[model samples]
Target: TYTTLDIQNLLAGGAGNPIGHLATPAASRAPGEDEILGRVTLKYEPTDRLTMTLKASYDRNSVNNSSWNYVAFRCGLGSGISQLSGYACDNDKFVTHQNNMPADIAANFPYAKKDGQLYNRYESYAINGNVNYELDNITISSVTNFNRNNNRWTCACDFQSSNNATWATENSTWRSFSQEVRALTSFDAPINLMVGALYQKTRRNFGQWVAFAGLRNSAASPENQFVATSKTSFTKGETTALFGQVTWKIVPTVELAGGVRYTHETKDSFFTQPYNNPGVTGIFRDQNDPDGLGVVNANQTFNNWSPEVTLTWKPSRELLVYGAFKTAYKSGGFSNGGINSKFSTNPLADLTFDPERARGFEAGIKSTLADNQLRLNLTAFTYKYLDLQVDFFNSPIFAFQTLTADAKTRGIEAEFEYAPRAVAGLNVHGSLNYTKATYTKFPLAPCYAGQTPAQGCAAISAIDSRQNLNGAPLSVAPRWTGNFGVAYDTDLSSTLKLGTNVDVRYSGSYLASGFNNPLSRQSKYATLDAGVRVGAWDDNWVIALIGKNLTNRLYVSGVVDGPSTGSGTGTAAGIPADQLGFANLPRTVQIQLTKRF
Candidate 1:
């Protein structure tokens, strides 16, 4: 549900619960986002054999995501005043609301804070130049690029209704430069070749403020008290790569192609929050201030090779078949949720992770039939992914972390486009895919609420919690997903035309949290969308009206575990609620007007 609800006593035979998330129940007002971008390009051809192109761009975006809030019921010792309804409440979720004694800090309390969920601003600039020279049957090209980005964001780390966590913010800057040079041969020979080399360097600086109030189940941060921990970090990286590709046309209807790339990369980062003081009184210092306490700096190098090979056959002008095998790699990096106390207990959480790698193969066929009226394609693929990067939201820490896992997956995809001869202005297109993805090794996946010791659940707070998920499916919906769309266009007059389209999408059930969280499961659903367009037969102006999600399916798109919620104990342990759900947008309509230049 988009809004949170207090379902303590209202489930079976109780009276009812309260609503959450939305601040103005009777009104709707949203902020306006602004974005600006400018670009310029220049091209020159001084000689018949040489050409040069240069482009530069600047972009800025300001966003305000401060319109969301939520209220939830947690387990407290006895009963306390309900913050949302101002009512007295024992155990809340499935029992009576209770509060704690004067001495007990863990009291069942109401959590219903509102507004300023998030805000962000970003600005970037880029400049790129390309040079190409042609000689005989070979063409040599070089590309150089320089880019910079500055970004900032703030969040009310506390998702509850209380002002418990008015503390999370970040500022970051990144600068990068890269250059690549390659030569390609386009000779009318049986063999073709392409070779390239690339070098890149990037530098980044970041700073963040952790939750000053800290995450609590039934409590808010001390008023006028500032316990925010300040942390700053930096990263520097350099990479060099060499790649080449060869294509051999063995026969008129058969061909073979292969390519390989070797990369050497080095990374250096200050991954520790040395300035963070894990005491009752936290120091408010920035990253620039020299206060070295903790220790988790990363200075590592990695080498990898990526290769791909393909063979193709064409039996006729309209039919083609191909198969290929490929390998890929992604470098690992540090995380930046600031100094987390859980890291002290689970040192691995603060350490750098291994690189992620994948090897896969695919076979596909493409065909056109019925006098160019039909086009169809099909592909089957399988892959083994090692050290896959997975993102998790640690509700207690109000931070995001990246974990690693090993997975295996196989899938098939099919698509088709058709234009019936009987209907000159009608077209139909659709695609379908089915995948089976499973975690071959994931011993420390986050457990859902209420998971017990028998379930291999363990925790040092929600941020460092884990459970066994080795045999679970990697994707929530590992079955079938597909979409079908149809469009029709007809000329109404010599200068006007009418166009209409309808699309439908279907998906199997999946977990909103991506992990195997039972409480965050989303049921199988389908949606319908349709649109109408009218224009002066292309050359001028056009108007379009579109309706999206006409079925108005109510489903959760993602979730964040509530405070101490994923500790696997749940409210039964007098903690926070299981999870907070973010719902997908409902049915909506839009009207657009366009003019061609």
Candidate 2:
């Protein structure tokens, strides 16, 4: 299947620039994708005491996107606005309407004609085998798995009448093999125990290149074009772990459980970009010398222990309470991408980050009311993170960077279901969650675009600065989110059953950037969904009609802050720094059919 998208924007007057303009000429943007998936599973019971299972699957997905971004706004185009003061100007008044805009406008306007295209292909396959053996007093299991993935992405950034456009490509391949063996003792005693050992080895090969089209006299001629490329490669990683867990019945109505895992991992990476193109010297600096250009050969090792403990109490058959404390760890890896040679110069300045560790505590209750007609579960949890891994845009170049910071999160989640015995074939369910996530300590966060030092940023330069986001809430973390739904099913005839369901979901407002700038915030919004299904022959065949986002509410789903550049078709200075991200999809309706054997 292929899909095409037509994006339109309205240029409304703002406080700073109060010259309203009609819609500009529309640009062409389209993205295409294809996906395929397959899986196979086999099981055999050669004997009464042993069983074996094997499974394999494959998935492939590809996408191709091409879009033209029109830079229609420029500074100092409005009346009484001094061009030297750097204010956006409304040039639409000088040109014809969007329907009959002249081609020569591209020559008179200061807009940049940008044509960007991206192609990505990803394929992965995995195979697994498992064996289970039962003994008189215990059960033993062994499993082995292997997986491989290959991905390639290429992007073309073409600008009109400019030699600065670039073509970037990245190719990655991964292979992993893992083995696990476990034993469980089911003794007729008050306590039960299980232990496991696991080992895994993974290898990765990655390559990237960025090519530039140097100064060219004409877009059709490539005689003067030269390409400047940068690349990085990562090679190997291995991990090993041992885990054990035990459960004890301390009393008739209470139980205690504990588990622990010890893990150790090591990784190696290499990077090199041996290119020297004079055309792009002003944009990217080459680090190659007599030794090499930006060559990084490094290795890192990490080890950690994670533990978990839980307690449960059941006073009666209808109610239960539980509490748990757990710890988790994630291994760290190297960072890649960017045109900077800092890694080659400093070697360790920002090459890698520390592992992330988290400690979490949770308590919950489960209850059944009105003689099992209603069920409710509620849980509250708090987690403290040490060296949490975070990804953010590095300034000046807008390259993505990974760092570590201390953070904390607390949240409450609740779910309930009611099925009244008197109301036949009717049920209702709802869930709600509240989260308060914050950065406990982060001193090196970059200030968002247009943010001043007084607004929580530590001044360093006019365009570069850091901020202490110690108490700032985490990006994309909404304080309130909830979903409510009701369902009904009834037998319409001897051979058919009809069912219907409706649900509503909502999310509160949240910041989109680490700087917590109000300009980068998304407002609260809600969506509704409904579905109807008809089944026949004891559900052997079924059909469903579903509708999503019935109201078609338009809202921003994400945001990013970056440099704003203009195409040569507008006045000058293009559009001001504004939030950039995709918006939620409009309302959709679909019908689906299923048959079971």
Candidate that would win on TM-score: 2
TM-score of every model? 0.79, 0.80
Lowest-sum lDDT 10-residue window in model 1: 97-106
The whole-model lDDT of each prediction reads 0.65, 0.64
lDDT for position 201 in model 1: 99
Residues 436-502, candidate 2, lDDT per residue (tens digit)?
9999998877665545545555656543467788988988889999999999999989999999999
lDDT of 1 by residue, 242-277 (tens): 999999999989999999999999988875553432
Candidate 1 has what TM-score?
0.79
Q: Candidate 2, overall lDDT? A: 0.64
Tell me the spans in candidate 2 whose CA falls farther than 4 Å from its real position.
1-32, 66-117, 156-167, 211-226, 281-287, 290-293, 338-344, 396-399, 460-464, 555-557, 565-576
> How does residue 456 of candidate 2 score in lDDT?
59
Cα lDDT for residue 80, model 2?
24
